[model samples]
Target: MRTLTSSTTRRRLAPLLVTFSACAVLSGAMTPAAFADDARSHEWYLDAMQADSMWKVSSGQGVTVAVVDSGVDPSAPELQGQLVPGEDLNDGKAGETEDRTGHGTEMAALIAGTGAGGGIQGLAPRAKILPLRYNVKAPSMDTAPRGIRYAVDHGARIINMSFGIELPGEIPGLREAIDYADRKGVLMFASSGNAGDKDNVITAPASMAGVVAVGAVDKSLTVTKWSNHGSELALAAPGDDIPMRCANGEGYCSSGGTSQATALASASAALVWSAHPGWTGNQVLRALIETAGRPTEGKVPSEYVGYGFVRPRMVLLEHQGDPGAANVYPLPNGPASASSSPAPSKAGQAVSSAPQHGEAEAAAGSGNTTLWVLLGLGAAVVVGGVAAFVVRRRSA
Candidate 1:
């Protein structure tokens, strides 16, 4: 068996054991009292994304997002009554609510936390969380596939994978499981990786088709320097300078990375799905893509921010975005036919090089042109100009 290293920090593990490290990104400890006093203030993305306005329309009440990661602490104030019983693929003795690394808890909170007891408020406050635990330190190849299948079988509408493995190619059973989840109409989101400023190697499951590979953006709405970029990237969300529950459960901590971005994207999907319960996973994803914030200048699907930053507000509040054909997957590497099951292709590589029509038009100024056109109007003209400059600076 080949060994796998986490996309976050690279470390040696025992032979035959794969390491699926939690994409902790960047983290710093904070005391409980201090966190209670100032934690929510650090969540700048909530305000920037206009979460308050979106909440008035939908709180993701009926959606359940499965978090595949270290584990979640059900006892946390914000997570109370938010967790559905989940299975632990690791030892199975501790169950899924016990968090060893705290990363899972942070991701859970980011998706559905209720903001009680001064905790971090989730993007979809009323959504439920289903935690699926795997052995991060010494997992086998089957670990991720098992967790994914469990989430799909257990009524999880969306799956959030906040960890990644850097492999030269796809893992044996992982890709098939993702396709299975897709065929089942389950939407999956994974972190694009946090090594953007470094090696920036494409990390799997994220790069795999059928999974939405999410990158990171800061409070300025510009992609973060550490958020990995590639053809596989599908969307982006706020990740930098975010607040999260500390692993030790003492209080909160400031963290940043694509992992957080993935959580927010999942929550965004939950909100859209909750508002439109009859919408299929494909429709929900389509709405997100159609309403996403694209770069003012660049190819429609930029290697950095894929379709662009996720903006559920445009779909939820403004009633914008067209939910396209429910059965047809929207992305380039999506299933070939309308059957929902992915068309057969090479084992690991993505097949399609062309962008979707809507994506292309959106990029070419057919739709949403009024929203971002001002970005090209020069820095002194509009806020989007500043954003354009920042995006170019970081990507350069």
Candidate 2:
């Protein structure tokens, strides 16, 4: 998209009064609104994921993310109407909903931008983006598995996929459209590749196997030599140099990779699946990997950063968690089922005990650089030579 990012220390942004609703005001085709005053005052991970008490609870509304890539203009005024109509497995010539390369409109305005116009204010700020539009840059090999089966046949529960391929094999129609969007449950994130300090490559629908991958952290939780790590990652977000809105929202650019951390881990699973709308996408990925953000306690995960950086406010405001079962599969190794075989990983328990009810802006430990981050849903990376959807700039 457009990046240059920076972070060694010295940062602020957490005042957040946030009220919005004269139809979500503030836009003069934003970007550069005096640098920082509103429009999420340059989003420092939304006050380290408190975002005005998780938008009171969850502004993700009904939820409907399906941002394949290479398109999604949605008229840009912080994405008017938040958008709903999608499709363009790369056919409408090129303007598929229209976006060329603001990097899918900066991962769809960082997963539903609602800062109105100064831009960049989305961590599910009333989530709603469904612009499928493939043709990634060139190497389509079938418009990214027909835009992941047209975003799980039109409904789109969740499927971010910022973009990636690395080419080697496993393109069997994107592993049969990721086992048909995991038998239509959806959820699929991606990104887990920025090159992890160059050539630590792994890529594939984010190394396939149900897809979640992600990775990328900075601001101090470390792990950003270039993102991309192994054991198929599974967590981590915040891809440094943050700040977005380029692709025609006029100005404002300072993107990162892991494609804005897979659109903030798909807007933190559309705010814990819009506050548990009956929960299932394997219980909202087992309550965001059991309230993530671990560094140690017993069995943490890490090729770089996994199972530890996506705290959906400790499962939506200290209710803590346990969203297991529901066709189980909490991620741990992969590719091991030939038929209906999904019940084993009841997932972890000691999320260090999980209880931040006192929320002094949470994040009291575990690399507490404002509590790591989330949103690096794979894809959108290409070393060189590409074409049916070619790319290589998540802030290269």
What are the per-residue Cα lDDT tens digits for candidate 2 across 166-271? 7666777778888888877888888866666566665777878888888766433345666777777778777665665433443444455777787898898888
Cα deviation of 367, candidate 2, in Å: 42
Best TM-score goes to which candidate?
A: 1
RMSD, each candidate, Å?
Answer: 9.2, 19.3
What is the Cα root-mean-square deviation between model 2 and the actual structure?
A: 19.3
Error of 1 at 352 (Å): 27
lDDT of 2: 0.64
For each of the candidates, give the backbone clash count: 0, 28
Evaluate model 2: give its TM-score: 0.31
Alpha-carbon deviation at 307 in model 2, angstroms: 22
Largest lDDT belongs to which candidate?
1
Per-residue alpha-carbon lDDT of candidate 1 for residues 112-198, written as tens digits (9 for 90 to 100) = 999888887999999999999887788778889999999999999999998888788887699788888988999999998877777
lDDT of each: 0.72, 0.64
